[model samples]
Target: MIRRMIRLYGTWSAEYGLIRTHVLIFCSILEKSHKSLIGLTHRVSMDPSARIYSRFNLHLYDIVVLVVSNAWAWRCSTTSTLLPFFHKNLGESAHLDVGVGTGYYPAKSVHPFSKTGNVTLVDLNEATLSTATSRLRHAGYKGTIDEVQHNVFQPLPESLRGRFDSVSLFYLLHCLPGRMEDKGPKVLANLADALRPDGVLYGATILGRGPGVSHNWFGRRLMGLYNKKGIFGNADDTLDELKRALEGCFEEVEVKLVGVVALFEARRPKMK
Candidate 1:
């Protein structure tokens, strides 16, 4: 349906990216509404965060999220801060990326993915899976790309155990359900199971507030709305708890705050 719409209207529109973004966002809302009518409870439908990316177009994400939100709202410079952080830690061997957003890192990274390695993308949202896969391929990632439709809350299957040399959790923690103290560690433990003992787990997450967090007016406004809409569950999240969570599962943990986002790395998953 989306492909057909893109072909029908995209071919004719000068603002093709804008049109696709609007269409996809609207379609996702419609899809959510249709599901609610079918069987999803009212409570389930309220938090559209989980199913929100089902129709997201990568270009739209780049413009709005990477450009606008990261600058005016989050105040984190993607090119200088985020991209460098990602490049510094990205795995050259078997890699796992959880909560893969439109596959932006791979699509825009200066650090190339290993053509001889494997990249396993894990996400509950199929739209993200598809989009990320497309982005990786577009970026000339010659390695094997694997998509696993799975929740971060659950343990990865045995086949995935100790498989990856690196795992990324970019912008994933805050969007998860429940408070960060509970959700954060549980999710970390689940991912730890997927990594080899020497593997590194690194990624960034937007924090609600903490010692290092500073939210400007725009950031505050967006945070409030996102939390209220159930798009974010990090209203009460703190950096201390996140550090504690990472330290619990990994022998080495490092966390730095850039704007309202926390960039983190944990190595040597203490496998149980």
Candidate 2:
């Protein structure tokens, strides 16, 4: 028993890394969260990547991912690129958002008129789904706010078919498992089931490779860390493959790479 205990601690200390080892130990001992640590170990073995977005992690998302990671690590500026694209495609009527994270884009969007509208938030993570739903409601969106805890890899609910004026899939594709060729088309086609005939689908994803994709030292470090942690599965993702995936799902596909990120808009779902 003593030897087994030593082995476990050795692995845990190494796997948790320096900073997280300290923080998690403090959290665990202070709260007596031995069960939580065990559960966390189980979660990692299960590769439930979405579980990484705990309530605590959600609190740090905007500042850590949006502001700091976007500018310094990814070389993409939230102000000049991502924010403008999000606002340009702001859905005022019957919107659907998949893989929502802290409801950043919707919370930051500006509506030309009216303070309320319908929005369906879909995510595999309960914390993210609840956080996004609450954020939209708090942002004065008094209309229908529905939450669907569903995976994009699976088929969308039949009732949700062709029900939205616009669907946004921002920062979602890269985090999904499988190659871009395999996952991208399937997910896009499934979401196409949610969009009206003329409705547009727009969002951005961090591309892993291609001619123009730039990964500086900081970006590389972040990419390595995220991929290693299973928080990202986009190491083999490329912009050209994404374009083809979009084309297969939509009639009009527009894609551009900005500092290793591909901002895309697809209109008129081909399968719709």
Candidate 3:
């Protein structure tokens, strides 16, 4: 898979002028052998004190991990395609993006809301927040942007509660500290509190239980190793548990499993 990814990026480098350098750098890094990459990932994942995102510098994260592995190679189908489709519903609605890493989704998704509405980006990492804010501005987003260097594991400020028309938690929950059974419900409830009446909650997450790894031997092995190392907190975060968590907070909920990722569109009911 690593060889294939290297070859794939090499092909992309030859074709695209803009990202050619970044792609070549990605290929060079991967050439160091897949095992080394996995070992590095394992070390990062296992460190409870050092979150993976906070541990890596901006260049390694933005250029290599975010650009090459996530955007170019496409790890999560929900983030790559489905989430963007749902995000189009944000037409002129105030949106809050929790864990807005590198502003990938906001940059890729058309933000009709930016002209009339505002955007609040929240993340634990200051560098990530700055990078995302800068990336969005560079991508031509002319909206009132607010950056909050706050951890999602804690409650949001009272001023932000029940303020947004939409709240996005793209690829956030699994990366958080603690068990998903306890953390997942709490996170959803906190985000739900930030939504205005009839507001929409939409995003994607990596699921530990899914068809992608079940059928592939190598994929299953990799996931097992990741889960054991605390890289993924979703080992027990099954489809049923996720549905129940959403249903507990929102009046309406829809969830679909795309490969090893879960795509969801949930809504808070309007108050009487």
Clash count for each candidate, listed in order shown: 0, 0, 0
Candidate 1's TM-score: 0.81
What is the Cα-based TM-score of model 2?
0.82
User: What ranges in model 3 sit over 4 Å off?
Assistant: 1-50, 55-80, 210-218, 269-272
Which of the predicted structures, 1 or 2, would earn the higher TM-score when compared with the native?
Answer: 2
Better of 1 and 3 by TM-score: 1
Q: For each candidate, what TM-score against the reference?
A: 0.81, 0.82, 0.72
Local accuracy of candidate 1 as per-residue lDDT tens digits, 1-272: 99999887866785767755764574455445545533533443333566555453344667766887788778888888988887777766788889887888866652467543888889887778998999888888877889998888888988888888888888899898788779988999999998888888999989998787888766776687667666678888889989999998899999988888889999988756
Residue 177's lDDT in candidate 2: 79
Candidate 1 global CA lDDT score: 0.79
* Per-model lDDT: 0.79, 0.80, 0.65
The 10-residue segment with the lowest total lDDT in model 3:
45-54
CA deviation > 4 Å runs, candidate 2: 1-47, 110-116
What local lDDT score does residue 62 receive in model 1, on the 0 to 100 scale?
A: 74
Q: Model 3's lDDT to the true fold?
A: 0.65
Encode model 2's per-residue lDDT on 111-215: one tens digit a residue: 531542678889888889899878877777657778998888889999899888788888999898789999999999999999888888999999888778879
| Candidate 2 lDDT | 0.80
Runs in model 1 with CA error above 4 Å? 1-47, 56-59
For model 3, state the Cα shift of residue 251 in Å. Answer: 0.8
